[model samples]
Structures are given as C-alpha cells and as structure tokens.
Target: MVINFGAGPAKLPREVLLEVQKELVEYGSSGMSVMEMSHRGTTYVKLHEETLELARELLKVPDNYKILLMQGGGTGLFAAVAMNLIGRTGSADYLVTGSWSAKAAKEAAKFGKVNQVVPKPAKYTCVPDPKSWKLDPKASYLYYCDNETIEGVEFNFVPETNGVPLVVDMSSNIMSRPVDIKKFGVIFACAQKNIGPSGITLVIVREDLIGHQLPTTPTILDFSIVAKDNSINNTPPTFIIAVVGRVFAWIKRQGGLQKLYQDSLTKSNMIYAVVDGSKSFYYCPLEANVRSRMNVPFRIGGPSGNETLEKEFLKGAEQLGMQQLKGHRSVGGIRASLYNAVTIEEAESLRKYMLEFLAKNS
Candidate 1:
C-alpha cells in the first residue's frame, strides 16, 4: 500500500474509509445516501448533531462553547476571524510564526490595525520569544496558528494573552493531541488534515465571542448566525460531516486523544531520529524544540538543501511505495506529514528507506 504524506487532504484512517464506504451508497436504513439527505431532515440533522457531539466529547469542549460546522477552509477564516472579532477593539494582535499566521495578519490588516507581536523573520525556523512580543492590551484578540504545515513549526505552549481573547488556527494538528479548549476564545480547524475531508471547517467559539462582528460581515461569516442556527444556516457539508463523524468515532475507539498524542510522538520521533542521526545527509530547518509533530519538513543535502539530491530522494521514496513526500513548491525539499491517520508502520517504512538511502549515497 502506498503511504500518503500530503499536508492537507491528507490520509484518513483506513478503518474510517471502510466505514464510510459501507454507508456511501445507502446510510443506515435512511433509504437515501447521506449526500442526498436534506440538512433539515431528521437523518442528516441527527448525523450533524452527533458529529458535533463527538467532536465536543473528543476535544472536551466546554458547554459554553458553540461548535459550528461551516463550509470555508482555513483561508476563509483568516478574514472571517478579523471581521467577527476586530470590531471589539478595531484591531487585533497576531503572532506571526510562519506562513499561515503571516497570511492571517495580512488579511486582518484589511479590516483593522494588525500589530504583529514580533517582526517577520528571515526564515520560519523558530518562534520568537514571548517576552519580546509587543502585545496590544486593547487588541480585540490574540491570533496564532498552532501548527504551520509548510514551515514545519508548531508552538510548544499556548501564548498567554492576559485577559484578551485567544484565537488559534489548529487546522493541521487539531485532534492529534489533547488541548484545553477553555483557554481560547475561538479554535478553528480545516477537517482535511487530522479530522476527515476538505469541505468542512470546524469552528469552536466561546459563547460570549459570538455576535461581535463588524457591521459589514456577511451573514454566513457571522459566527453568531452560524452558531444560533446550529450551523444549518445553509446547506451544510453533509457528506463531509458524516465522514468526520466516522473519523471521530474511530478516534474514540483508539483510546482517545492521549493515545493518539503518544502515537504522534512515536511516529514523528521515528522519522526525526533518522534525520538527526543522518549527520549531514538530512537536515530539518526548524528548531528542535518547535519541530512540528504532524508535518515534518526536511532537506536532503545539507542546510541549504540541494534540490537535485532532494529530488532523487523523493524519486526513491515514490519507488518504495511512498507518495506525496515532496515538500511544498514554495520551499522545495521533503516533508512527511504524520497526521493522525498515518500509521506508525508507515513511519517505520519511511525511516528504513531514509537510512538505506543514506548508506547508499553517503
């Protein structure tokens, strides 16, 4: 079987896929596929409510939080967050650690003043020290991306925002680890990475943070409307939501977040061991402490990354039944995305190939 390591639209647990397959045509005696069921109908409504419930149970989302199942991906939330919350203070603070956070800050600038906690760095290898952050006490919210898939940087700890509302984009690492949901005012994730499919974007907003949107905010983008209507303001992503429910059920079956978090560390450590032990053959750009457990970006030929050798490595990886091992085009190298669905056996296979390649080429 080919091991998939794409960053987004990544792998789903085989068991979840199998379960989805069984219900793809006709779902649980509803006499119609989930895709054909109306969002208002009992069948789809139950599926929607159950999916949200499973999400709440798995994440331990508090009763005060409203989990909305919406259509836009992470990019849409870049603007949606600003429109909704920036109205509170007419500005927001952003910690720009990597590409995604940088984009979010830029989008927020269109709506209000954006005070980047730290200046953009020459490269996205490490997060700036929190002590050096220039936080605006009057800012509407403090926004940060918990994990940056392309740059392979993840925050080791949550940033303290004093009393300010803390908003996080956990798109790439949402369910891979345990999180304290109460610490943040809003947590949004695109489902394709660790959850399920691409069409759904899960937004969990604290109750009070709902309804504070800019006057011009679109009805659909307003968190209050989405939450008040129970994320049924329009035709929701029914099929994607169903598949996400299956994935959550799969997660629950696997001993929940703690188990998956341990599995994540194991899977990531296996590959990082090869990279670190390779001496000079392989190099990871991010700092050791901030290295992402979900997406690992590394270079094949030294620190600057020799493109030719990196291309050769990917070619060999593909030949060995590994696919999507190539890094993002913007930063050419190798990236192994160890999302929740990527098994430890697949990680071991990649580790073995890296060692073999090192021995042959060194």
Candidate 2:
C-alpha cells in the first residue's frame, strides 16, 4: 500500500517484487537464491546472457552496439569514459544542462581538456539551441545527460553533431522513454534507477568505440575488455543482473518501449496538469519546454511557506502510505520521481492529496 517516490533505488513493479519473493529461496529450480549463486556458474551465466539479450530487445538496440554490464555506477563510468575516449589530445565538448552533466564535465577535466558549453540563462531551465553550442571539431566526443533528475530538465531533441560521436549519461531516465540508440556512440546508465538494482551499470557502446582505451586505463575499466569478454571479465553482479532480467521481461510483457513511452507521457501530463492548476500555489522552476517526465520538482511558495507546506504534505501523505516525498538535499524542494513502477492510480492519489492539501492550507 506504500507509495515510494525516491529517485534511485526507487519503487519496483509489484509483480517483479512478488516474483523475486517467490524465487528468493529457489531460482529456476536451482534451489538457491540468485545472490547465492557464483557469478561464473552456468546458471548465473545463462541469467546474465538472457538479461543482456532481453534488454537489447526491449530497447531495440542496433546490432552494431554491445551492451556491457559493468560494476561501477554512473559516477565511475564518467571517469572511465574520459580515460578511455579522451585520448592523448584529451579534449571533449560537454553540454552543461544540469548538475549531473556539470559533474561529468568536471570529472573529464582530470584526464584532459574539457570545453564546457554553458547554456544561457545561467541555470538549467531549458536546453540550449544546438546551433549555439561552441563545439570543438577536434574534440573526442560530445557528452550530455538526457535528463537532470534534480533540476527536472530534460532534452526534448537530440543534437545533430555532424560526424562527432554523441555520448550520453542516461542514469535517471533510461527506460522511462524511448530513444534512438543509433544516434549515439555511447549511452551509459546506472541500473538502480530504472532497470533493477544498484550493483550493476549498463553501457551500450557502438562496437567501433570499444578498443580505444588509453594505456593508462585499468583493464577492468576498459569497455573493450568488458565487451570482448561479454562482461564476464571478472565476477559480475549476478543478483542484480537476475533482477534486471526480470524487469526486462516485465517491460516486454507491458508492450515494449512504445508502450512505456506512452505511459510515461500520460503520467507526466497528469502530474503537470495538477501542478499547473495549482496557480501561484505551486511553482516549477524549470522551463515548460524542457521539463522532465520522470522527475517532477516543484515548490509551494517562498522558503518559509515551502518548508511548512512540504512538512504538512509529507506528514499527511506518509499517514496515507505515500513515502519518500522529500526533495533532494541540495535543491530543498519537492521532487516526485515517477518511475515505471509507479501506476497511474498512484499518481492520481498524489494529485488528489495535493489538491486537498492546498485547499486546507490556502
């Protein structure tokens, strides 16, 4: 009965949780939990391979791409990407649209030169026009994050980079919407947010981008090595991969990316309507054209009013089985993360509660 709105490690599908519960003691007749199995064991290997294949199918990933299941989260991939792709020249163009993209640019700076393309208005309100970007033709790759979880800004259009390879960090909004994987050379996401669990990170890189790691890069951190070995270079996160496989099956059963995209749009529109209908009582700072469909952040009023409002909302919602409605500590506003697991009914419940709360407070 509880509703969870935390960003990462967020709520999972009820059927997925139930399936996990049923298999917690015996997995596929193996008489052991997926976590108890050795990563190198045949059962685990099958699970891993099937999981990767299902994910590729769900995303409709191109044949030229290799999906890798790696250990580090999105943060690790940021450094690994710079190390591997930003060669001796060590220069790349970065689009700074949100906190995550800014962090990626900062991490890339440690390895080489990074030209950060700052969007105008000095904040992440909307995506900068592609024509305005001062991109370096000699740069390794252009890096961006598709959605900023904290800021609630999302890129509605892909940048046309001529021949430059586009790399994206899709950590918080990977499976929430449909994306053309062929348009990018690399797309990496931490699995905890949308896929399944926290231990595994998914990287989909074009086969051509694989073998270019700098000599200083660790072998384990190299995408070429991981891709070549089918992500079995070392002990994989077997339990997480198993759960991700379940998620993939669930997505497939729910009718693939197109259906997911529709569901996300519907849920997002529903919530936005409620926020917009609140008039001055609710304030969403992000530009409407670039608002995120996955993470909706808003404030009730000024600092004091926002604090009191958030407290009352959280207290009342928690009593009614809604949880994790608090915003990010850095932002100090409300953030309601609507992952794939959150149903339309739950969203409506939240909207109903908000309407009632505003009526009482205002």
Candidate 3:
C-alpha cells in the first residue's frame, strides 16, 4: 500500500478510517449517514458536542478560551481574524517567518495596517530571532504561523508578547505536539493535517477576544456569533467533524499528545540523521535551530539543483509503495510530512530508499 506524505489532507490512522466506514452507511442506528443528518437533529448534535468537548479536553485549553468548530480553513481565518481584532487598533504586527505567515500578513493588510517585521520575502530556512523582531506595542494582535509546511521551519519557543494578544495559525503542526494553551490569544487549526480531514476548522480564542468585529464582518465570520452558537451558525461540515472527533478519540487512546510528540521527534530525527550523514549527498536547507519535526524538506545531491536525480528518487520511492514524496512546486526537492498519523515505519522505509538511491547514483 502506498503511504501518503502530502502536507495537508495527509494520511490518517487506519483504525479511524475503518471506523468511519462502519458509521458511514448508518451512524449507530440513527438510520442516516452523518451527512444526511439534520443540523438540528439530536444525533448530529450529540456527535458535534462530543467532538467539541473532546477537543477542548485534549488541548487542555484554558477555561477563559472558547473552542469554536467552524467552517473555513486557516486561510479563511486570516481575513476573519483581521476583521474581528483590527477594530481595537487599526494596525496589527506580523512575524513573517515563511510562506504561510507571509500570506497571512498579506491577507490581514486588506482589513488593516499590517506591520510585517520582515520587510522582504523570507528565506524560509531558519526562524528570525525574537530579539530582531520590531513589534508594534500599539498593534491589536501579534500574528505568527507556528509551522511552515512547505519550508520545514517551526518555532522552538513561544514569543513573549508582553501583554499584546498573540494569534497563531497551527494548521500544520497542531495535535502533533503539546502547546501551552495559556500563551496565546488565539490558536486556530484546520482539520486536514493532524486532526482528521479537510473542511472543518478549529478555533481556540480567549473569550475576552471574541466580540470586537468592525460591524462589516460577515455574521458567519463574527467570532461572537460562532462561539455563542456552538459553531452551527451554518450547516457545518458534519461528516468531516465526525471524522475529526474520531481522530481526537484515537489520539487520547494513543496516550495523548505528549506521546504523539515523542513519536514525531523520533520520526524526524531518523530522517534528519540520514540527511546529515550523507556528506553533502543529501542536505536540508533549514537552519539547525528551527528544523521542523512535522515536515522535513531536503535536497538531494550537491548544490545548484539536481532535478533529474530527485526525479529518480521519487520514482524509486513510488515503486517501493511510497507516494507524495515530491517536494512542493515552489521549492522542489522532497518533503516528508510526518503528521500525527504518518507511521514511523513509513519514514524508515523512505530513509532506506534514500540511502539506497544515493549509493546507486554515487
């Protein structure tokens, strides 16, 4: 069976998929698929509430924070967050570390003044030092993307906001690791990577930050309405949310987020070891301090691009039942996304293939 390494909509736990299939035909004698159930139906309501409660419990979110299960991916929140929070101050500060954060800052600019600490496009290797940050004390919120999937860069520590509310987009790395919930004003992640599947978005926002929209924000995008109504303002992604609830249950059963984080560390360490030992045959671009544990991007062969050999490596990997190993189009090479569901054995298989490919090419 080919393993998936795609960044978002990545591989899922086998048990979860199998379980979902069993429920797909008719959910526990409710006589309808979750997709067919009404949003007002009791069966769907229980399913939704359980999932939301599980997320709140698993994340150990502060009581002051409200966890809203809403529609829209992280990209949607980029606009929503700007409209909701920018009302307080007409400006916001953004720490642009990689592609995602840079994009978020650009979207935020449409609603308010954006202070991008980094004036130029980021190199997408190492994270900029906090000491180098030019934060605006008067800004409404300090925004950052916790991990950049395409660039394979992740932050090692939380930034000190000095009472300035902080918002983090944790789409790529949420649930793979434990986070200090008290650190940020908002923690939002879409359910495509570590959670379950695409179409559902999870937002954990401090209750105090909920109701400050500029009156023009869409009712659906308004944090107060979404939070108060329990995220069913619209029809909601019922089927996807059901799948996410199962994923959350699986995580809790698998010894919680701490255990999953250790697995991620082990998986990433194995891959990095192969690259580091290859002696320039395989090299990672990101700096030592900020290498991501969820996504590892590396280039094969020497500098100046080895597109042909990289193609061969990907072909060989596919032949060996590994697919989605090709790097993103923007930065081509290889990207192995070790989301919570990606197995260690799969990573080891890729490592072995890499070593074999290098030996043959050399």
Q: List the global CA lDDT of all models.
A: 0.93, 0.86, 0.89
Model 1 scores a C-alpha lDDT of 0.93
Give the 10-residue window scoring lowest on summed lDDT in candidate 1: 301-310
Worst 10 residues of 3 by lDDT: 117-126
Query: Any residue pairs clashing in model 3, and if so which?
Result: none
Residue 16 in model 2: shift from native, Å? Answer: 0.7
Which lDDT value does model 1 have at 203? 97
- lDDT by residue (133-170, candidate 2, tens digit) is 89888888999999898888989998887778899999
Clashing pairs in 2: none
Tens digits of per-residue lDDT for model 3, 56-120? 88899878999988777988999989999988889999998888898999999999999987666
TM-score of candidate 3 on Cα atoms, chains taken together:
0.98
| TM-score preference between candidates 1 and 2, better one | 1
Please provide, for model 1 over 238-305, each residue's C-alpha lDDT reduced to its tens digit, 9 standing for 90 to 100.
89999999999999999999999999999999999999999978999889999999999999889889
The number of residue pairs in model 1 that clash at the backbone is: 0
Candidate 3: which stretches are off by over 4 Å?
Answer: none
What C-alpha lDDT, on a 0 to 100 scale, does residue 81 get in candidate 1? Answer: 96
